[model samples]
Target: MIIIVFHIDSQERTYIERITQDTAEGIKTLLKNDLEKRITSLSEQSKLSVISSGMSQSDWDAISKNLYGTQYGYQAIGWIDSTFHVRKRIPKHNNEVTIDFNLALNPPALLTAIKAQDTQQRAVTMPLAFIHGDEGIGIHIPIFNANTRGNKLDGFISGVLLFKPYIKSVVPDFLLNEYYFTLFIDGHKVYSDQSNQPAIAYAWSKSSSYYLQGHEWEINVSPNDEFLYIAHYKVMRILIALGLFITFIIVLAAYTYLFARSKLKDERYKIEHLLKNLPGMAYHSSNTINRPMILVSDGCENLTGYSRAEFKKNRMLWRKIIHEDDFKRVEKSLNEAFKVNSPFELEYRIITKNSSIKLVWEKGGPVSSIFNGEIIIEGFINDITSIKEAEADLISSYAFSDAVVNSVVEAVITIDQHGLIQSFNFAAQVMFGYSADEVKNKNITILMPTPFCDQHDQHLAQYLKTKQTHIIGVGRELIAKRRDGTQFPIHLSVSEIQNHENTMFVGLIRDITKQRASEEQARLHTEQLAHAERVNALGEMAAGIAHEINQPLTAISLFSQTAKNFCEKGKLEKLPSIFEKLSLHSRRAGAVIERMQLMTKKGQRSKEVIDCIFMIKEVINLAESEARLRNITIRMTACDEAVDVFVDRVQIEQVILNLLRNGMEAMQLNTCDNGSKIELEIKLNEDKNVEISVTDTGAGLAQEMRERLFKPFSSTKENGTGIGLSISKSIIEEHGGHINFCDNKPTGAIFMFTLPIYEKRSRE
Candidate 1:
């Protein structure tokens, strides 16, 4: 009994062993293909990195931004005989701060490539040796320069593939299963699976091997023991069936002698009839060369498309009927089964009479005659063509679905109705720095920060009860947490999907950090452009400013001379008024220069609650010079009443000055009796905020000008940068104010802006 049971167990073990070996081969092929492709890609990128090191900075920058057109992620560097040097790298985190490949002494492949001219090589992985503790696998291409004498090796261009994460990011998540794997570098093991044990290939493990440019990876994969439990159960069932068969045979032989000859013959015929009506053929073959099919049921001809006589005569023999590709496997399995004296179940393809193929399963055991040493093989063979085809279709459908999910660029995730994560794809793994293996069946809130995580269950509960949507259907920007506990912006869109007995939430998420960064960068560029325009505006008004200062200086000089003359002639009465005028002129000149200086300076200054009256007066003073030169008389209303408003001083002044100058310029096109009056006003508005307006009696505005008034680079002035009004609008909006243009009374244009009131603490 023990021997028989062992026989059954051993055959199943052999079957499982074969499955594990095949799985290893497949894994090996996949890994080798990926690694070799990576080597080739790095080699090509190395050439570019080398050649571009001597190119101009701009060209290098463009190429680096594109990762040198390589599909995989690697940092490229050029190698002089002594050291590794980077020409450029982009998404620039990979930029090498230090150059030290130590290629002359380590990673023999790099040295080999360096020895030859323009040769490419792949080298062993070195742990945390490059750029932020990353496993760097060296791929080097020798670089050359043609001198006056001959072409000589200039250096080697090297690309260091950040190996670990690169592999994680490229390989499908489904493939990273429980199979224990060890990645060997040269002959030394550098990486292992989650098992973490350094294991050599076992009889059950699968191995993948890759060798290129003197570097290699021998990958061994051993399927988890749990994966073979089904086979173990099948072996138990076969052993039980064999035991019962022997017991029945012993009982039948005793009964056969007791029964009459006719009764025995009748029972034999009844058994044969029962076997013939079964789903498959029942057969007993002689254990001889050619394995002659001496007896077979009627179903044999139906399954094999051969007549009963043909099978009995061994014309269309069992061995010859097996498909060519499956013949060796079937034969090997049978040999192993017989060696263990076990019953075997095998799947093999058979060629039919019409030359079509049919998949079949054969279950058989060796039998020996009791009276003599005669040996026979008895078995049942069944056509499993439809079942196999259906299985293939099912597998194909699963593959298709997996492909679609993996192809999506977004980090797709699915969670159970209870908020536990059910699915996570490759993108999700890359985005969160967590493998699916690490997070599967974990709470979806693991990807969220404090408040979101805390509130997630409530949100789902609320949704289930109310069926109202907040974050469903629409994509909204939110912060997501990574495995490292860092937060990043993600655009999340989620929907409810029903899965048989439960509800699941499918979330489509995308990292929007780069997009937000780009927006911020654009805003800064706009601010810089505005500052340049302001400086340019200052330049345009230089002559007018000089004229305003010259008048004050001329008045001061005249008054001083007059006072001196009075002193010389003993006329002291006229000196008092002259000194007063001189002091006023100096104050006026200083205020104009100071306001101009503040407005033209670069960058943002902190906002403050500035006095509205004071600000209006200063802006008018700055523009007063240009206003007079343009023949525009400045008038003010409500200039003395104190009102405070919160704003950036320079930015606010810039808006006011721009409005004043624009009004003055407009008046240049329309001259009035009072020389194109420009009115500057400051007062409290209905909103209890400070309102400042610049009104002009110029040509006012054309319909088109009014429409595009606050648009950047939209101008009517001959030498206008067209940035002033647009910048003013931006500043006003940023300060929580709104600026607008409207008709001034009946004949002019008024450009007005309002600033929020500064809320001072009320007296207790």
Candidate 2:
């Protein structure tokens, strides 16, 4: 009995020793591997941060927080500059005091950092006390400037690893509970969980070593009192009771059988739980024509709205549930897969017990039945209705957007940040004289003219870099080039579309060639209309003009006669004064003719600065004789200051003369008993504009005539051409002014117009 107990004890001790050795090796390996992985990750991150430019505080904090979460062994992660100054640290709330700490204060860490920088590699320091009172080692990863040719050292990413927490983290709780451990670094004990009590002499112990980053770490593992009591002493006592060995053997066999059965039952329960929680249905089916279901998981009810018992009772239930349209395809796929003894995938619709249709995807393969070794099919079916619906929605969205873009009348173009055209709509194709295929992937500069095309790329790059916009979100009228090499005006509005992945520009372009042409034609027509009106006014004043010219001509003729007589008489001394008078009369006749010529000339309208008061005086002079014939008096009022206006002189004169003539005619027709008068006033208004008013003491306009007063071809007088007021309004508005008529206080009508006061800057 003693020999058997001794042998059992020896064998148990040997077994325990072997387990202890393996545990020690495993712990050492786990610690080494975990540290190496963490250091490698830190090194890679450090290099990436440096390559990105420099290790900023945010970058450092991000890396530190990530390491703190994933590499939990680290007490703190920090950045040390090239000068060995601690610039940043993790767990900012707790470790903020460590920032700006000089690494020189800790000789070991400083040495490690210096070595890492010099060699441009990773280095580690010996275990030392950190500022936070935790004993740990420092891991330093060097960073260098990638942009420099010399690869100058930049900084170091340092991680402080706590001893006890690191060991506890790497070693599993089960292993830790059964075993006592001692951690050593370079032969010096750093951590040990053994109490001050003298170690048990019978405890099993083993030591294992692992090397990492030039440092040697040893883990010593030993079974505690509980493990020893159960595995060695108690077992020895059991072996000593040799008389009950047969009974013990019988009981052991039964226990082994029951334990195995319990284990199998537990495994089955886990599998059942897993299938119940599965997102869809799992099934086993017979490899037959109908593919009858042999077994189904609990999820079958959720997926098909039918109980498992129903599927078992009705062998044709699966076939009946398959949509008629997809059953044949499903059967064909299954047959093909079965023939080749391979896996199959199918997507089809199925009708649930409630008569609702659902789209399902199935992936299955042939397998041998454990009970009979017959081939059977097993598969998982998942509802994919939502996925299919989402796909359809996405496709429809894209199609709708495309249709809308193409339907617009203006050109719609989308370009990537690089200025390459990505999409060109139908309008763009028609406007630019290019097919969508021809312009796609082409630079947007192809549609721009001259210097703009050459500078487009540079401008785009500048905007991307500086984010300063010149034309984005703003509309500009610019010249655009067509495929035919013709340049035309286009109004382009560009908008920026930005997302996380990329930036794009959408350009809306409108071809304004026809619009510009129409405008030019309108301007020419206005000039012609103004000239025709001036000619007509001159014709109306012909009699008065002839009478006025006759006086000057008659005087000139008399002066010439007198001068000729003086010369004939040889009174040369008196002839000088006679000749002077002749010159004055001739000059006066020339001035009258020049004024007439100006009024009659037909040409493009040219604006020049002229005094408003002076222009009114000239108009009155021409119309004075006509007014006198109509028995109407013309009066003028002016301001002391000269009000200069920029306008076409002939156009303004025509407007005033038409007003004067109309007033005189109205008074003649009305035959007012009181003397009729037309008053012209020129003054500066509050808007700094030259305001001229013509008041007529004749019959005032009626209310009905006011509405259509400025409309062409609408007149109150029987012989009046309504175009006079219409033309006057157009001419005044064109000169940045307005004209309107209102009833005077008591009687007659008042015609008032204002022209912007001309400044020197306006001409420029």
Candidate 3:
């Protein structure tokens, strides 16, 4: 792994360069450990010098205040005791100060007085000065002031007579021991033992008297001579105790050595006795000799049915006892141990006197010349026939599992956690249209569609963390992308297998595309049959009703023409009577034809993009005669411009005509209605499809007939054909649209159909 640091604003890069040109040799030289050792030595040296000097009790406070310019503060460097102590070393003009300031406790400093000339070691002194007062006043301050307000004779009495005579009799009581000197210059510490170099020094003086009334000091000489005599007495005592301790240790070691030797001999005797009576073979060999020889114990004869005399002198006899197939393996095992200077263990077969193969477990290790005068291999062999048979049974179990997987009808594929394809059964090859050789080591995402390819790794990571999987232990139907780039639906079942630390998944997939296609085709056929029935029933109703009403309609038209002709010829006196007769017949004939037209429209294809207003006007004109005969008026309100659509123009025109006729029949049948009228409206829809609604004010469909009204052969009228709505349904659906019917407010039914307006693509 490499660490690359880049500045986000400037894109400037810096690399941690590996400048150790002899990197391989540096690794072999253990350079990191060596560097760590050197750093530890420097840290220890700094610690030892500070601890030995007692700077806390002397002038550390004065030195720190002058040098660091702090009355009291601490700097943490490293551990001083179990708890880490902040050791502050302050360098002054001529000497440095060392202080252990542990803030956890209200702490004090260890002080050492350093003479400027000697800066390497601290000077040790004892009981330098003593002064006393009545309470806290003179405990830690100067002795006195020099000037006094008094007469000359009175000053002489206080100074020369009283204080001056008392000062002449004072001296120090204690001595200074092992005094060494140190100095500091320009923040660097220099010691007296280092060199006789130019440096500042401070010396201590013994004051005889303080004139504070009988205060005294005395300094002792010959301090080192007295200390050396005391150290010699302590050393003699320590040597006598150490001599006793060494004598005790020597006695204990000699007793333990003899006891351990005796116990080891007993163990060796027990092992040799056990080997003689063991059920299997035991032997030792010396490979270090010019010619290696095998020493066979008596138990070897029992295992191989060969006398030890025959094998001991002849190493070839040992090979003869091994089965022919096992001899090469035994030789290989021995050669490997000698090559690596390690141990050897193997299981193979040997031949006994009964002419049967016996499984043997053998283990050996190299040893120095102890049992013999040469380096040797010593081992024991055991019969392992039972274990060999158990292993054979395990192999048979795996073979059965393999057979079951191959026999399955669905495609099966196995992939490891890394998504590398591990195994693909024969059925999988055929289902994916890939040969086994082509897919091995390929990513499983080859079978996934685009977005799935991008998101599959994220899905794997989520499942691994949560231990939740959507596809495992359950079957799902999903689309699988094939090698040919075509997609088909499949039912896939996945199972996860974890062995040791490795995770794998097995997917069993079966193609279901053909089955779904067959079901869809059947559904469409059923719909067509229902539509055919509706059309046939409506045709029969229209034919029957139209045939019965046609003669009456012709008679009404003839009488109306005759009355109009007489009126035009100036027969005014007879006009009112004839006109009344003409009107009654005309109204009755219009009602009969209106019923016929509603049920009798036939299917015909009409393709056009006719203006919506014009189409509605033409259909209204065709239904006008029928409407007039029933005293029912037809109304139309259409958009000024044409709203065109791609459609079978004739069929839709017929549909409009049928709706007008149905509307006239509905309004004429209701005697209580104020106006006998039908309205047709055409308008553009928001989605660019044209909606045509034909609403009637006729009596609405009966509750029983409403549910089944558009079904094949279902009708409410005695002379009704039930095929109109069903046929209309088929026509609209064929144009990629739909038709629906709803109750028209307080009465009648509203039939509505939508067709998309045609959009033409421009040529490039």
TM-score of each: 0.39, 0.47, 0.34
Candidate 2 RMSD to the real structure: 25.9
lDDT of 1 by residue, 1-764 (tens): 78878887888778777876676676667666765776665456555644533576576555444544555555553443524434444434445453443444444444455445433234433343553555556555555554425555555545566656665655555455545656776777666655543343244666667665456667766655444444576568676888899999999998877786679779989998898898788988876545679689999877888988999877878877888899889878777777888898998899988788988989998888564767678899999999988999999998997789888888999998899998888889999999988999998888999999999999999998898999888889999999989999999999988767988889999999999999889878867976887787788789988887788889889888988999999999888898899999998788767767787777756888778787777777777777767767789997455788887887787777778778777777666632477888877888887888888876768888888888888998887888888888888988889999898766778899888888887322
Which candidate number maximizes TM-score?
2
- Candidate 3, residue 43: lDDT: 31
Per residue, candidate 2 scores C-alpha lDDT tens digits across 129-183 of 8887778898898877777889877777788888878777878888878888888
Candidate 1 Cα outliers beyond 4 Å, as residue runs = 1-402, 416-419, 443-475, 479-488, 494-505, 542-594, 604-618, 628-649, 673-676, 680-693, 703-712, 729-746, 752-764
- Clash-forming residue pairs, model 2: none
Give the worst 10-residue stretch by lDDT in candidate 1.
118-127
Judge candidate 1 at residue 683 and give its lDDT: 79
Global CA lDDT computed for model 2: 0.84
Tell me how far the alpha carbon of residue 293 in candidate 3 is from the true structure, in angstroms, after superposition.
11
Ranking by TM-score: 2, 1, 3
Q: What are the clash counts of all predictions, listed in order?
A: 2, 0, 31
